[model samples]
Target chain A: MKFPFLKEAITSLTKKPSTELYPLVKKEAPEGYRGRIKFHADKCINCGMCIRVCAPDAITRTIEKTEEGDKITFQFYLGQCTFCQMCADFCAKKAIELTKDYSMVGTDEEDFMVRGTFIKKLPPKPPVPPAGAAPAAAKAPAAAPAATEKPAEKAEDKKEEK
Target chain B: MFKKLIEKGIEKSPWLLHINTGSCNGCDIELVSVITPRYDAERMGFKLAGTPRHADIVVVSGPITSQSKERLVRTLAQVPDPKVVVSIGSCPRSCNVFHGSYSVEGPLDRYCDVDVSIAGCPPKPEAIIDGLAKAVEILKTKRRGK
Candidate 1:
């Protein structure tokens, strides 16, 4: 009887099973693992850089005009996401982050969506200039541009006619 | 009493039928790894079925391409009642980066209802296991209802 693997079998008898007890024992995804997306609405400047860089078009933005400011709502659809981290990489405000949570399992489509909202206040008007001064100040610049434009137009006409 | 016992048997061991409808092979690789020794998905009573008729859980990967759309629908229809449809990766759920391609026609829900969606470019093996566990739970509920 040739038992070629007798020594190997004896060594295997003492070895522990390689199978991971997955459900019973939870495991964490490694650091910098691009998984779920986290959008920081407050940190976002509404630059729209992330939207431009996203290959899947997973990020959607809706702007609503309100008394306070522009209410910008951004929706990140995880289902459509490729987990490429490009959106986070292009974000100028560091508003988007790819978390290490890999267990992004869900039944409903809504469950896979990540949303964030932020208001961007409009810039203040230039002190209003007291009403009377406003028209005069505005007229001065407006008239100056018109005056410069008329001369240029006349010169172009003369050239055309010649 | 025998009916209840049959249901119990079905709940304990739910066989999976993997269908790739134009996948880039990323999710397929991860799914194969899940069945390997290190991950060993079989320990949880999940087995890969050879045919759709024998499947209790249908794991669909990839964006449904124009060519594979018909076949995908036909395969799902064959998976008898009380079957759970699980979409692995962002491709099946929303077509991922392949959304606007002329050849791709998917986001799996258009054909059949997806019970569990595991979102990742190619989800980690652990995540795939988690999704499978959820599929198993859904399978139990479906079986009980039937």
Candidate 2:
């Protein structure tokens, strides 16, 4: 209502903004800021606690046994993620962690969702013995017992023949 | 005659005083955001007052820790009579994750009276404004016919 107040307001409006532009310009988040969890596939032990603690049932784990060992893959649905960062905190091996990249916008709901967020590396298994070794294992005991019985049986047969 | 005059004063202007007991700064930041360019809480005839003496509403954030109890008690005492207190987050409500800590000294009511509670880890900004509006309504009803 006052001329002085109006003049000050106009002058303030003409000045450059003091605050940084956000969302469009993209500000840097603080280090270790809890945003979304990224999985380190090779390091995961496949303990499955991350799946258990998820309040929304957003994670699913699939396990398969191979000649090598066990293989595990986990799928995470981002649409249901609450961004609570509880999953990363509870991970025992520190294989899962939250990163500060909050700019997750997508048109397709499926594309935005991250199913199979974790994969695990398995230890190499020992090789099976050759076929020849299996025959030796089966033949040794039978041959030893037969050798002892054959001499006794031959003596008995010789007496009867006499 | 004096009662009518006091009632009129409570309706036209309601000032708020904010106290932080101990929070992750999420609720604190959101509370400030309510006053910024987007929400601009002042348009609703609500204003942030510097001292408790000038306030009708007290907005509290965080779980009450041992370190914060004394300060909160002193501040609440300073606010004038016919006041309303609003607990702002899940921390003060159930203490959330910090519920069973050795140093936590609150459920808030142990120290002072609370009229309304807005429950969220850090409640959304729109919900915070809604809570404030509700508090003002309660203040109006309490003032009438007194």
Candidate 3:
């Protein structure tokens, strides 16, 4: 039933190349292409969601506070990451997303990690009292009572004036 | 004409070649399933080729990492002309998790042009078959033009 010579010639002549011109014609990638992890540091509220969800414990958040203010530091170790993308999905802050950029390779193990820092401004301090207005001369026990009575008398005088 | 006859022949028998750059092995597994008894991509005249030179379709998985970039490019170049490159999986289209790492050099589009991208961490076998079918259709068009 088969024409051997014609079949062989047709197959040989019709075989198209399997390699795409990847540089010229862009391939339409599928939906939800998980390529790379996109980081939105600005949107991160230091919630520790990404750190907690990371099964490999690849992420760590360090908070530092001083009399001046508070600073949040983030460390993401890609070497340990499983590339599960669970952290990005579970994150409530929407601070992280998986991008279609799968181009990660490093020779040094340490090169895979990333670190970021964020700072918060502190409030100003209250002003100190000026040097001695006679330092409020110490009053005797009896004088203390008189001093308290004087304030009461002053209040009464003000009431009368009003 | 001769071009139409060649296009018809190419549409009848298409060989696929797969490449795993640095993927999580998810897409690779699904691709293997295409040849299994369940899906049996072979029934459609689609067969897996061990070498790029014998293939008409290239199925690529994983993001293009610095380590795999040159090798992928070189291997792909070995494939014949009028080939269709299908990017299968989320990692190849986007970084997924390995994004900001210094070693990443992706978006695949930067390195080479992709013809069809099968989205998913690991696309189902049926989806892959569908994608390949579409690629074959496109191949027919290209052959017609040539």
Candidate 4:
């Protein structure tokens, strides 16, 4: 008896169907799946690293000078995003996160944007020095924060030399 | 009564016509895999039609390039009225990483209004199916002229 394909015939009968039936049974994206970008505005430091690293230019940041401070808003245009995760990697504050939500169907362009607004407090200005006193000017730089003291003196020195 | 039956059939089974402008083949491959036996999209009544004339929904993938601009327009014109245009990935929606390239002439909206856009470099198969299902719903509305 030549049963050329006998080994496969019985094996197929007991196996379950391979079709997923997605509409009826929902599936979950696995861990480390990069789907949608989630921005944590509070954690952001306004460094603009994410913007610099984005290959698609899908990220935009708007800085508005307000009485409160610099009102910085980041807009992630998901429609153009490549999900490359470069923006997330470059974010120093860990503000950018790509979630597992893959359902991205939408009719309007606005529906595809992710926006985050944060206010960065502007650094206080150093006190103005009197034009006549170079000695007072030396003390004036001390009024500013230690981080800005050296740069402030150097800037004033250039102005004086001019 | 016959019209009702036809509507039911249309709802159950929407034929899709896929056109690739200048994609990197990532989204196209996923779209094709949707029909494979493992996914078995046909079980849900979705079939990939051979031509635009027979299609109820058009699935467009890739960025619209200078070469494909006229062809895409012509293809869209060939699709019968009440057809739904589903942009399959980020490239067609906004040219993705290929934005501002010399050969790239578009984001899909530069030609015609995209009815549905699935966002991803190449969207997952499940997401593509989800977008297509939504497109079928929108097609029904467009057919009624609303």
Please tell me which predicted candidate would have the highest lDDT against the true structure: 1
TM-score of 1: 0.89
Q: Which is better, 2 or 3, measured by lDDT?
A: 3
Greater-DockQ candidate between 1 and 4: 4
Runs of candidate 4 with Cα error greater than 4 angstroms are A1-5, A126-162
Model 2: reference contacts kept, as a fraction? 0.00
Off by over 4 Å in 1: A1-9, A130-132, A139-162
Looking at model 1, the pairs that clash are none
* lDDT digits (tens) for residues A12-121 of candidate 3: 78886544433244455467765446677777777787887876566878889965577887876654455678888988888777666443333233445567777655
Clashing residue pair totals per candidate (backbone < 3 A): 0, 3, 32, 0
Worst 10 residues of 1 chain B by lDDT: B137-146
- Chain A TM-scores for all candidates read 0.79, 0.59, 0.59, 0.77
Q: What are the lDDT figures for the candidates, one per model?
A: 0.92, 0.71, 0.72, 0.89
DockQ value of candidate 4: 0.76
Second chain TM-score, each model: 0.97, 0.91, 0.91, 0.94
Off by over 4 Å in 3: A1-162, B1-6
Across B48-142, the per-residue lDDT of candidate 1 in tens digits comes to: 99999999999999999999999998998898998999999999998998888999999899898899999998999999999999999999888
Any idea what lDDT model 1 has? 0.92
Query: Model 2: how far is B123 from its true place, Å?
Result: 1.2
Enumerate the candidates' DockQ scores in order: 0.67, 0.02, 0.03, 0.76
> Candidate 1 vs candidate 4: which has greater lDDT?
1
Name the weakest run of 10 consecutive residues (lDDT summed) in model 3 chain B.
B118-127
- Fnat for each predicted structure, in order: 0.90, 0.00, 0.00, 0.82
